[model samples]
Target chain A: MSETTREQIRDVIGAHANLPVDIRELGDAADLFAAGMTSFASVNVMLGLEDTFDVEFPDTMLKRSVFASVDAILEALEALGVALV
Target chain B: MGSEVRAVSAEQVALRDRLIDAGHLIPSGVDGVYGHSAAFEDLREALGTRISAEARTRGATRLTFPPVLPVRQLEATGYLANMPHLAGTVFSFDGDDAAAAVQGTRASAHEDWSEFQAPTGVALMPAACYPVYPALARRGPLPAAGAFIDAGGAWVFRHEPSTDPARRQIFHQHELVRAGTPETVLQWRAQWAQLGLDLLTGLGLEARLDRANDPFFGRRGRLLAANQRAQELKLELLVPIAGPEPTACASFNHHLDHFSSTFAITGAGDDPVHTACLGFGHERIVLALLARHGLDPDRWPAEVQDRLGAPR
Candidate 1:
């Protein structure tokens, strides 16, 4: 994966989320929800990810836990056979 | 937490046992069916009246429906398409008496005797408000101010089996439903959510209104659930009834043109009237109050006793 893929995701998350911490502060394993990410905002993140990756998330991965962290989202994409450039 | 770690808690089990022992929950040995105690039913009914009185004052017409919905109505509502896993269709033995006898004999012992029964072409009403749209549609067109109905019934069935006391198979839903201009319905839902929170909190229960969703079916339903939350179409008023997470005692739903299109309901300018419903989960609320206070309603907080008219 290019630095662009990861940074782009971080950018979208930063743009979509209404939270205190800067995007740079969140590690891949950091629980975004615990960091004040909300279900309502998570939807926008999903929309952003869908648009950014050009892949639609299947039903199994639409749970709140899947959007718990950046790492979890990456795992879901991997499960969907998505290869981030 | 994931469902794997969702085993019933001791507190929940104890409360269930306490209710059963107190004769509030009469067991039928079946997974879902139960005989409700008069006392318990009284509390539920009183809660309904007390809660609904405010909506009625706002000109919500009252309507009650039977537990079973005609198959056609469910079809119109698109319920099966979205949540087939949760659907419980009613069936019967449409054969001769001999067939019935054979089925009965097979069923006499602990066996799958239901195999003899055939589809009766009806479905158990999943939500109390499912039948309202079609019925209201049949009335031709909505009034100029649009239609508002207080509708629901008991024994709505959703085929989700669990040890969770808060998630019962059979329960009552009394909803204050609005079908009118988009703004009106949206505002109604927002207002009632506050009303629901206030009502529960006023009784000294820990109630909070937050984003929630219906248990939709697979694949496509995930998108639907996400879209719903994204649009903020559903809100739940929850109280910690049984376990770690608070149980949903009431819900506010805004069905944006979904029902209007399904039923051809329209508001002024003949535009599709947006719809919303605020539903109260009867048994869940009663159990929450009991769990929060104590078994005896008499021992509940004095202010609460007066508010619900429960004897102190």
Candidate 2:
């Protein structure tokens, strides 16, 4: 479930980031914003993540760095107590 | 009727071209600034008169602030933390004649003479409501029901430079600000948001109320944006002023405890006051009127002219 969740979130992030490079080519720790995730596009990515997880991000988890990289994203999810499969 | 209302492809682009051609707006030598014609000013004053009448009906007190805002008061709001990109602080040369001469030479040579100028300890007021919080703070406590202030159509500044005529550097906001309990302020703003759409639509302009977000800063701002939308903290009354997308002409913001906590406004039971503001962009409204109705106010639909009152 954890692997699936991570992969699912990552896929949504890549699709919405609108980056020039393929999200699959980047390392898990690579910065998504550095590659081009605009503040506008990030909203779409956020909504996508919420749909995939069946959870709405609480206010405490709403911060830029959480969406900064794949690793950072997983850390945020872990804080939500999602088990890492 | 909705489909009959022609949604122009590029309203801003079209507005700028047509407004200038019609002598409704005059170009100033600065980006984002324009000189308004008498007709345009009249539109603002007329709108102000109508809004003022509504405010009086509600017993709302009216106040107008100068264009400049105290830098300290502005900083206290912590507005810069999220939207530093949008504000413009006032600054000046505070040096001696010799320093002035040096600055003069630099300025003449097109060098960065402005570097020598000191901070004016103030900034151009970015929104009509910026001064309201501190003004309320000066008074010890709020009334049990709290208070509402009508800030009528004053000049506010933003750093956005745009060729879109509706997007001016300096614009006017006829704002109604309320400070009260969470229920009082929020409900009032929500009411006005819907009323605003009805008013515009009644005038034959295709208007709608939609959930909206402030142009918050950076990646961190994305979270702010999402949170704002999730809570439905903002409301915008959009009209197809320019482009395929509707443009927001008026905005309603629910500050919850943001402004009260900043300015220390306390209500009954000594709780932090909640704030909400409803602001209408005077110039944008005028442009919308011109775009939808004819530029000649005399030729406007009888109903719109009746709502706006007689033109000068």
Number of the top-ranking candidate, with lDDT as the measure: 2
Query: Could you tell me the TM-score of candidate 1?
Result: 0.77
| Colliding residue pairs in candidate 1 | A2-A85
* Per-residue lDDT value at B129 in model 1: 86
Q: How well does candidate 2 score on lDDT at residue A24?
A: 88
Q: Rate the local accuracy (lDDT) of all candidates.
A: 0.78, 0.80
Give per-residue CA lDDT, model 2, range B129-171, as digits (tens). Answer: 8899889878878988899899899899988777888778899
User: Per-model TM-score of chain A alone?
Assistant: 0.87, 0.84
| DockQ versus reference, model 1 | 0.16
The estimated TM-scores of all candidates read 0.77, 0.78
What value does the lDDT take at residue B251 in candidate 1? Answer: 92
Docking class of 1: incorrect
